[model samples]
Target: MSYTPVYFSLREFVDPAIFAARGNNCWQLLSPEILRAADWLRGIFGPITVNNSYNGGRYSESGLRRWESTVGAKYSQHKFGRALDLKFRAPVTPQQVYAHILANQADARAHGITTVEDINSTPTWLHIDCRNWADQDVPVMVKVVQP
Candidate 1:
């Protein structure tokens, strides 16, 4: 029932319909890296509402497409359970959070943070992921301002 330890619960990550279709076996099947990313994001930004009314974090397969169709890159880390878009409560900006992670990237690495993004469309939430990456040889940092 939480986003850590068992980070990908059906009630949280999977949409109700998706969860019903696939059943519970896959509900808690998120990657450890994804869990670590959630942990890292929590450490940097306190009290994030991942599955609240805001819909700030994890998305089911259908959920991802429903909200992010315009963004393209359908097969994003999110679909593969390697990414999350998180929003902090207050007193935290995307720039500040990004810099915080960048400043302490070595620490952030353990939490599987290979990529950090600030989509200008919604600067409050930071999109973080590692996709198929298995090492930290080169991390990708991008800032996209959707017009």
Candidate 2:
């Protein structure tokens, strides 16, 4: 097994809304694979808009409830430091981002990574995750989700 170093962050918060909503600022950990995946995604997108990444463990209960009503569970990969949700510029669908990720999946897999659709099956964002295990490519959906 590849040794994935544990990364501890001193940042006050990971997700803004979660922080504003929950009134807490703390993080658990993130693996190296997840960091590599995040770096690869940022490089591919080239300063694209981002929705969420590395969430802090501080959110108002009500805010978390509201978030869950839409996105489900305040605790997620974003909080765990192994995932990223990206937003595209105008006229670009989430499916397009997913397709882009899939197109580059070959290279991504080489670094032990994978991507998935946005929550609620909407094509507004794409979620990418990385793990220390450099295994085979995990099957992912590359279809466009229309609103």
Candidate 3:
């Protein structure tokens, strides 16, 4: 069988410039760890929609800088393609989503999910990532209540 990519498309995971780079497409640059983490999210949450005109979910280095200026995180996982911010639609509340992930936190290792942060206090999106796994002894699923 061939290596078929799923859970996300090249465009779904990064901005157009990434695709334009061809030889260095963001899809090519994404860590398998992050991709598997995304797949795990889809497995538990049904489906996840990323970038849209409403709120951008994924990013490039530049996009990450823009988000950082707006949100104040200089070393965000998104900057490294190791994180994804998600949009939650009908029948799903951020609380529900976070709870669900927490319920299965033990399985995170199998899916490369090192962290799941609920930044639901503001625009409301789930920030999940698998970055610098060496720093984590186990998956960390926590809700960030903005001040």
Candidate 4:
């Protein structure tokens, strides 16, 4: 049941350096859960931007980040390809999306979204990750954390 994104391209999910080094093989670095979740978000939230560098935009660290990258925490889920920072278009905001996910826990869980960074911590973007919470004995509700 591996899921590939229909609304996104491989270049949109990785940094320019990674895309240049691994090409399409970079897809191997991204988790299927994260990929599926991204597509699901797009279907529900309309247009969303991950890494727009592929299209000459400035965003490149919104998705999978390199281990050596200093953009986030040393152990950030973005480095493990289990997370994404999405910037939504007009008619929708990150806070709104975050509220929707929190309000629809079951739906978010079904889409493999185990965590969402707190809206206050990430006011401009919605950061969702598929980090494994089973080993942590966390409850079924999507865990909201401060990045």
Residue-pair clashes per prediction, in order, are 0, 4, 0, 0
TM-score of each: 0.67, 0.50, 0.70, 0.95
Off by over 4 Å in 2: 1-13, 16-28, 51-70, 73-75, 91-93, 118-120, 131-147
What is the lDDT of every predicted structure here? 0.55, 0.46, 0.58, 0.92
Candidate with top TM-score is 4
lDDT per residue, candidate 1, 60-120, as tens digits? 3422222334444655655565666666677876667777777777667766766676455
lDDT comparing candidate 3 with the true structure? 0.58
How good is model 1 by TM-score?
A: 0.67
Residue-level error in angstroms, candidate 4, position 90: 0.9
Model 3 backbone overlap count = 0
Candidate 1: the clashing residue pairs are none
Question: 28-88, model 4: which lDDT tens digit per residue?
Answer: 8999999999988999999999999889998999999988999989999999999999999
Per-model RMSD to reference: 5.2, 7.6, 4.8, 1.4
Error of 2 at 17 (Å): 8.6
Off by over 4 Å in 3: 1-5, 53-72, 120-123, 138-147
Q: Residue-wise lDDT of candidate 2 within 29-146, one digit each (tens)? A: 4345655554565565554344323343323221112233344445544545555455555566667656666676667665546545444564456656552223333354232222
> Can you rank all candidates by TM-score, best first?
4, 3, 1, 2
Instruction: Kindly list the per-residue Cα lDDT of model 3 for residues 79-122, writing each as its tens digit.
Output: 66666676566677656776777777666656766666644553
